[model samples]
Target: MLLKTDLTSEQLLAVIFDYMAKISSESKLDRVLVLMANMGREMIVADRCTVWLIDEAKQELYTTVAHGVKEIRIPAGTGLVGHAIAAGEPIIIEDAYDDPRHNSDNDKKTGYVTKSIITIPFRNNDGQIIGAYQAINKMTEAGKFAPKDMELLSLAASYAGKSLESVMLHQEIVDTQREIIATMGEIGEIRSKETANHVKRVAEYSYVLALGLGLSRHDAEVLRTVSPMHDIGKVAIPDSVLNKPGKLTDEEYEIIKSHTKIGHQLLRGSRRELLSAAAIVAEQHHEKWDGGGYPNGLKGEEIHIFGRITAVADVFDALSAERVYKAAWPLEKIEKLFREERGRHFDPAVVDVFFAELPKLLQIRDELTDKE
Candidate 1:
């Protein structure tokens, strides 16, 4: 076996760390896989590769690559991939057909032959097997891979394992953040008539609108979770103002409006991106495009972009909902208000995006309607 001496072990570790950092900060699963796939191909001299992640709960393996192949899930002890995971070790099969561990049925379905295979299990720092990373068909100068080649492949797999662990940690942090935001939203909902489902719908609506308005997915996600805080200030309002059957008295209305300021103050000090977004929603959701609404009456482009977007979402959702003071308006009536208020009470461009997927918005509302 001939070796390429472009990078020393120290250099390889540095490159692997760089890849791990890139994967750790990334949220999109596709981009993460693409980066890792390129790393695998360049770091190891391989041809025609596929990486499978193990789902132990489902006893399955899934592919993130779109190489004319979907994922294949076999029993834990069935195939070479499964065996590698079960034994928590790497498996190098020079001739897959001759090996008893080979599962040939998957290739028949995909109409691709597997000549050679390498499956390595990736374990986290805690010693739990998170997934398996596999690379198939080493394009050799000769007809086969040699012992030294297998050794290098093993080293590359070790780096890949560390990268996979970093991804898992990143995912865990994201899931935890989502749970916290949900709990906070639910708590705020209890202070009013809003249900958890209502909060969820508004969050989804905000996400769709932000994405349509060309916001990055990260920004969209932050706004999705934060938009629910628009009415979090209502938690501080008196029930006399909150549950008024008729329209609020001027005094009551002033008290009710103070919730926006209260919510803004409550969320303002947080260093978190979501809380910062929530603060914007709280402070400016009531602000008018023409400089008329809210505590500060911030006008036009002076309002934070997030604030403008959330203002539309918050009002649209409130109008469509059945509240203490009023019944739910018809979809047509809400649509008319959205159209009429364009650039006066709401951002016209955001409203356009909201209307573009109006059918889906109605469907979501119907799906998430409070059951009383």
Candidate 2:
């Protein structure tokens, strides 16, 4: 903890400004909240800090990054932070247990005794209160939050509020785009008379495979969001070919294969990162590692990693689940096929990742199992 008296006022202001700069550049909400909490604890010289956001839709206060606690949710206006938000002011409690507004449930749950607390409501750009910053157990010799602590926390809260709002808006937009992609993927599946869960399972499996192959979380999430559209081209296929219960003749099969190019054509022109990725997945998910499989038969690493990973995920789901034309293969059969085709039908590394993440993939399958 940085002792409040150790820094001159100018030094303290410099430290706060430095932290604010970091908070402004961050795009992730959870990371922004963590920075805000760290800034509050350092400025106030407190043992811990929590940045709580108001969930207006749920009428609750939630904190995903609370110090020493798992994610928690409490009714709006239920605790000290809530009270501060409701009153639209800063609060200093020398003894938390003695205050009627303080909630001891967390203290009891964590077995950490609360001594002093200072909470300051934070506002959005419009000056409407959106959340509160709560610092606990002052580390100074006084062992209690002073008015100065409240002032320091207030400054941190003011900057954090705006940054949080911006990051949250970005998150909302990303979430909407993901939803639209997944919905479009489902529509394509439904057009071919396949279950919606097929797309969901493939997306989740692709995420597991991507992560197992050492893709960054953000990239893995991008794969998850767009993998559902691997078969989007199927929407363009004639229903007779797409939904044929019997074996497809060579001509019908060729027509069926054109969906990949169709899906790519539909999404390839988009400037959006999500759509661009979806185009790759739509176009090349069936390409073989040995230059034997599809539209262009791109060989080995020439295939986009996104397409390679989706191939394993899509094939696994397709083989393991019962389809109109075939019964679900047993686990042994699926494993045998994967082993035999490790470097032929699939990318060797991707096939390895699929087996490594098989447990998680199976869990995803069970969780999103298609309804009978």
Best by lDDT: 2
What is each predicted model's overall lDDT from 0 to 1? Answer: 0.76, 0.89
Q: Kindly report which residue pairs in candidate 1 clash with one another.
A: none
User: Mind giving the per-residue lDDT tens digits that candidate 2 earns over 45-161?
Assistant: 788999888999999999998888989899998989888899898889889889999999988888999988888899999999988898898887778987777777777887788
Off by over 4 Å in 2: 1-14, 249-251, 366-368
State how far residue 121 of model 2 sits from its true place (Å).
1.2
Residue by residue across 1-372, what tens digits does model 1's lDDT show? 343344467876776777767876776666777667666655555655566676667777767663456655666666887788889888887888999889899788887777777777766667777666666666655545556656666665666667666776666676676677677777778777678877888888888888989999889988887877777888788887787777778998899889889989988987766777788888888898888989898989888878888887777778898865579988889989999999998878888999997777778788888786
lDDT of 2 at 270: 79
Could you say which candidate leads in TM-score?
2
Per-residue lDDT for 119 in model 2? 87
